[model samples]
Target chain A: MGIEHDTLVAISKSWGLFYLIALAIAATAYALWPSNAKRFEHAKNSILDDDDKPLK
Target chain B: MPQRADAAALSYRDCVSAKIKCLRYYRQQKKRVSRDRVSLLFMGDNDMISQLTSTERQYALVILVLMSLCGLVMAAGGRGDPLGVHGFVVLAFSVGLAFVLISGFYAPQPDPEQQTQYYDDPTKVGIALTMAWAVFGMFFGVWVASLLAWPDLTFDQAWSSFGRMRPVHTTGVIFGFGGNALIATSFHVLQRTSRARLSDQLSPWFVLFGFNLFCVLAVSGYFMGITQSKEYAEPEWYADIWLVIVWIVYFAIYLRTLARRKEPHIYVANWYYMAFILVVAVLHIVNNLAVPISFGSAKSYSLFSGVQDAMTQWWYGHNAVAFFLTAGFLGMMYYYLPKHAGRPIYSYRLSIISFWGITFFYMWAGSHHLHYTALPQWVQTLGMSFSAMLLVPSWASAGNALATLNGAWHKVRDDATLRFMMVAAVFYGIATFEGSFMAMRPVNALSHYTDWTVGHVHAGTLGWNSMIVFGAFYALVPWLWKRESMYSPKLVEVHFWLALAGAVVYVFAMWNSGIIQGLMWRTYTENGVLAYSFLDSVEAMHPYYIARAFGGLLFLTGTIICSYNIWMTVRAGKALATDNDAEGDIPVFARNAVQAGE
Candidate 1:
């Protein structure tokens, strides 16, 4: 038998929309939370650290 | 402890003091075995196999032997089929590798103190291989482009036909060239940001060469007319299964290294890289779910069919662009852009926002590829909406990269290497916007199957992906080789201009041809009949095809120039002991060694 296109379409449009919205909000919150600013600041400059020289 | 290259130039007293200080540093380090004492100080540019312990060396050989046995079984069992040819190829690769390992079997064991330094042997070879693929791949790319213009410009053999050769070009550039860059740079960035060595020595080699084996099998299969007919995921079932094993090792190595990380937070670049690796595994497995006809045959049927299959393939196809091309290159952009400019990323929070946004929005957007098809209309609208929204995050990343250059604009002007990155970020912004625009239904009506799609793909690949990789390579080569700079900054300047002209000419010609073809197809006669025949549209594209081929030749020439310059840098460039790009490693042993004042 062929699939039920309408039922699947309804689920995708409704639930998919809500799920992504909530996920986006949570992600933004994690990025911009006030208490986390200091950690982000340190991480920014961290990778610029030079590698060690040969022993001498 | 040992002689340094600088020791010869030093005054006699300073040389002795430096040596004494190095010895003291080694003595203080409790991890070093007594046998490793002198050898640890001599760890400069030793051949690859000499850097492994005897046990690891033997471990590698055992693994290769088992692989060869599998190949041998396939060769014996799958005789008189295309599978036999592939099996024999695999057997040759394994046997060749085993022979090399046996030759190097008696080399001295590596120093345990190597754990203190980041492992770079695979990354070094990975870079050389990246260039090799770039030259090889871009040559195929130019040939493919010219074939579209001339149509009879190939050898009179089915193997050289466009159907076979097109995949060779795509796989060559994407998996061969771009994949190597991602692997090589990921190792460097991961070690630097996490400030930890790779999880183990053996697995990095396994991942690099194993991935290359998959690439080799993929392109070679196309030459033999063996494919599952999936775009991008074109390799047959055996090759696919082999990749799953390789990818698992790759993932485990990444996670294991992250577990050993010294930093409190995972860096944003690593988040993009992790997403690239993880999502690609999921995408690959899902899209390539096909049942082979039998054990000995190279034929297979996809588990999905019809519109469902259409949806699945686009789901894999678009996200391959999203993750493989976009995410991995973004990982490179984040690390290398700020690095060359000596500026920090403009907004760390924005990086996180861009990462999460693209990751979320992109998967749904693949349905846009199925627009105006038998797929339901609402699904197309949903893909269109999400795709338009995706423009926000893509631009955020690109803008953040550009905004990083606020204080370093002078570097962009004077340094061609830095300019390559700056231009790449601009192209990223353009291509993403173009992608969003084309995903909409009305735009898709005009642009979907025309040269516009080809143009858009090239806009991303040539303008964005390859540009950033060259920038990263230019920045990395000197640092990895311990040279002062590239062999020629002048040649780099030449390369950048050539690449820019090629992308510009190719894109503009395609844009012109695609619009003309679309408009010709859509226009109606006075009595409301279709206007142009298919042949008419084909005729209109001929001149522009020639223009595009010439443009491709320009890009190929630049790639060739890049390969030669890198070769010269490796061969004749001055060698130095280390780069002073950063203040050096912050790990405890390195800190202590720095304090030793050698």
Candidate 2:
């Protein structure tokens, strides 16, 4: 019931690299996208303040 | 009426009195179980029974009862085996927990207004458990290190042998001390970052206690000579299964809390924690696929054998370090380092770049552990190349942390807590570079089975992982308990020096000894035959082993002092009840205004 070792390696060498690289690109794009800059900026400063009370 | 008895039994005067007695009782009870927040939680009268809704408490009781029943069955069915002993251990543990729950079962429900505030009782318990495990783990560490130096310290017992206790020390510190710290800080950071309380009350407790149960099983199993013999993945089949169940609940809690976040974007720390949790689950399940000889036996055989088995083991081993030790702590550094420094992260963009970089590179670098072994040469080279690539992301995060301390240099000098984190970053950089260098083909030939590898691991574990944990504890303990600071700042300074000295001593001793040992093994006489006997190299290791043990003692001493400092701080909080820090967490979104996230 076990798969062949060479087959597993071949698939990992091909599809695995592609999947990982694509994910990396997507993550980087999400980070550097211009419109999202404000959100990142706000999130950076979010924990610094004492105005953390839940909305009444 | 039975549930209300807990409240009735623990009045204000009675609690204060017990608090006084508990602190006195705590030191003596350290060798066995107790001295954790569990006892302290029950002793406190303020919001005592109201933290959990009645239904949640009953939910916990039912689960505990079922768990205890399972333990009883195991104990009965596996009567002649070591599995039976573990079954009794589980029964004691679960039944003890059940009593705590049943005692609080009939208490009044928590106020609806409490839903508005962040739930932190679990975090409080987690910190206590972390320190308890720290002491428990490091005690074994020092004992085992002493065994190496002296070799006759084994007190005439089967359990005291080095084979069993080494895993105890590793599993203890890694899962016990480090894992509990990760869970505690994750809970605290998740609430403040997401501006949401935990989604469900019972599940957080489930995750926390359940994870501890797995740690207990792993450590105790090693004591009883029950292991699957994988380096880090050693806790046989059943304990592994229990961990899987606990992990899924943990991840679900994280996802649920994130789903209810008030912010538009998830923070960087949560990303690291997510990777830590998600990747560890994958690593664990894949590496631990084994078949038991029978339903009652504590033994199991791995699915793969030969080179594939070795590769799989190293892949799991190396990545456990990647996800469990490195990534989780980096997630912690992302939050606590910046928060403690009172500065924003140096570059949000760098955080993103490094996060993705680490995520991509670390998964493939495990093959480096199998270099010069039976693993394929091509795979080894791939591992080496990827390990070298890891330096970029590793240094990126380390630099990001150090850079964020740019304007806070004065705090780094004046505040010992911040200095702990600063030194952690420096060591993180040093260790990652050392790791990449050692993974190369030529270097691996010298360093593969030598003390050099041990030195590198300690440099990472002691310097990076343990230091950052102390930093987080120093920062978070005060905030969680509403105290102004640690019980004694002077002791923190003392701890920093001791820990630094310990790590330096341990790592350097190993480096010198490792090179000598490696050189001796590779050396040949003028007649082209082997020069030194293996015993000569072993005898040559005597002094360095002694030095390493002394270093570990220093580190363990510092940890003991830290535990005392934290314990006194908890006591200090109880004494000056109103000398409180502000209740600062993330602000949840309002009902009517810009509907960003709920």
Q: Which runs in model 1 stand beyond 4 Å of their true positions?
A: A1-3, A53-56, B1-44, B577-598
After superposition, candidate 2 runs with Cα above 4 Å error: A1-21, A52-56, B1-38, B41-49, B574-598
Docking quality tier of candidate 2?
acceptable
For every model in order, the fraction of real contacts preserved is 0.45, 0.59
TM-score of chain B of 1: 0.90
What are the lDDT scores of the predictions, listed in order?
Answer: 0.85, 0.85
Superposition error at B203 for model 2 (Å): 0.7
What DockQ does candidate 1 have relative to the true complex? Answer: 0.41
In model 2, what lDDT does residue B173 have? 94
Candidate 1 Cα deviation (angstroms), residue A12: 2.4
Q: Give the per-residue Cα lDDT of candidate 1 at B495.
A: 96
Candidate 1 CAPRI assessment class = acceptable
DockQ values of all predictions: 0.41, 0.47
Q: Tens digit of lDDT per residue, candidate 1, span B443-467?
A: 9999988999999999999999999
